[model samples]
Target: MARIVRKPGLRRRGSFRDWLTMLALFAAIAFAAAYLGGSEPLRGRAIVVDGDSLEVNGERIRLEGIDAPEYRQSCTNSGVEIACDKLARDHLRKLIARQDVTCTALGLDKYDRTLAICRAGERNLNEAMVRDGWAVAYGDHQWLEAEARNAKRGMWAYGFEEPSDWRKDHSGEETSRVSAKESVTLHAKRMFASLIAWLKSLI
Candidate 1:
């Protein structure tokens, strides 16, 4: 009978094969990701529906898949006006009450409202306001909601200084009614540009 010899420096042939198989699997996954990441955008009309919604240029138009403050509707946290109620009107006026905006309808919602995601130029308009502290994420969208919370963006940043809560102290007075200087407008424009640049990279 011949004695079997063991090679101390060599791994089992099956182990070598397993490593090769894993490398092949990883390569396949990377290839699939690159292949699926095509450059074409979704088909739609691309029109701004509101400060946060859009009407794509297709047969369908819908609110982007982001929840913005209902404006006129309200939510409360810690017994304070930490949510947007009819105040959503302020967002509309401040962001898109008159902007000739556009969107790329991506999908639809259950109520039949277009559930498309949208953008303004290269920036996501919905996200812009949320990030600017003008609005808050609505519903249970933990991802964006978390972003808003973490960045202290939107009403989340205001914390206890929410307009409604302040109204409790001053009887819902219009703070925006106070006039400001030209520098304020210039500062806002600059901030908007910065926000757009940041958001374009998101898509």
Candidate 2:
């Protein structure tokens, strides 16, 4: 009765392969869900809500990667105060100027506002705001901020609290928010660097 001899190793290998296939399928499903659920681009005439926010087709969108002063916030220039927030908002308005704005959604913010990279014609509104110093680089556009600072453009010429700090001060909340997108990107970069280092060590 030596008719049955199934090797345990073969069964184990089959199980492992099945597990891997299932994992891959789950990963693909999750990716598709995230993509399909959000990330739909919004396009319409943009009404300037503030420096870093706009209303497009009745939808409120917060510009991603930049932060502008609160609408009521002010700043000091030389020895006089300036309504930097108003200036920033006005700058944004001028940039849009009744043009059809296109916004590509990244995700939603804590306030449930769609976070997006918006463009007016061929110009990137977010980059323009930071480059012109109407906004500060919250998670991206560090180089443009530097250039604006060096050039002393818009709010860079004035002394103002960072938008997040201003919000915390006025709202009496201790919220120092960082962009989730930026945090994830930074983590990925670090992981890649670590992997490269490990590979180099192996060499």
Candidate 3:
């Protein structure tokens, strides 16, 4: 019987291949952490979804500490009819202004939108909305909201139902009343208005 001998370089090549495989795995984990839930924060250009909702890099997020009027909800300012919901959304759009937004994931909302405390530059978007009177502080920012109300800013400048109240009163009516075409048209208008507002902010 002849003794078998293995080449030394062959063993070295096997070890190198093993190291490459480990490196690839680490890269994959890092990629997932940066893009999904991990130590890194979620950051992206945001699209205003509604008064209290936004989409960043295709992920929907809800402001953690505030609620704004629902789309189609109406109000009055000095007895003149105002579209409070649209205005609130527009106000948020103006604040974001095509800036890079960063969100710290707080959790998930009942609607499945990621609940987050987001910021544009150094400005906290959630608190900014409440301070400007476009949104009502829900969890613990009521004091800031009170200051906005006292100043009669944004939605506080008008007589309007609380967003939470409006939802209760409507209760499925919004979905039943708005046709698909009407909803699409309204969404387009809102986006156009947002674009114009963002452009103005740049000037």
Highest TM-score: give the candidate number: 2
For 1-203, candidate 2 gives per-residue lDDT tens digits of 67988877998887876776666556555654565355667999888989999999999988888999897999997879999989999999999888899998875565557778999999999999999999999667999999999999999898989988888888998444447564334444454556545544443
Candidate 2 residue-pair clash tally: 0
The best candidate in terms of lDDT: 2
Clashes of each: 21, 0, 0
Cα lDDT of model 1 by residue, 1-203, tens digit: 99989897467766866776666556555544443333245543344433344444443543343444433434556666644644444564455444444544333343334443445455566666656655444422446656767887656654434433454456545322111222233334454556545544443
> In model 2, where is the ten-residue run with the lowest total lDDT?
182-191
User: Which residue runs of candidate 3 sit more than 4 Å off their true CA positions?
Assistant: 1-39, 172-203
- Cα lDDT listed for each candidate: 0.47, 0.81, 0.76
Rank all candidate structures by their TM-score, best first, as comma-separated numbers: 2, 3, 1
Which 10-residue window in model 1 sums to the lowest lDDT? 175-184
Question: Candidate 3 lDDT, tens digit per residue, 14-83?
Answer: 7876776666556544543453432356999999988778899999988877888888988897788899
What's the TM-score of every candidate structure? 0.39, 0.72, 0.65
Candidate 1 lDDT score relative to the true structure:
0.47
How far off is model 3, as Cα RMSD?
A: 14.4
Residue 10, model 3, lDDT = 95
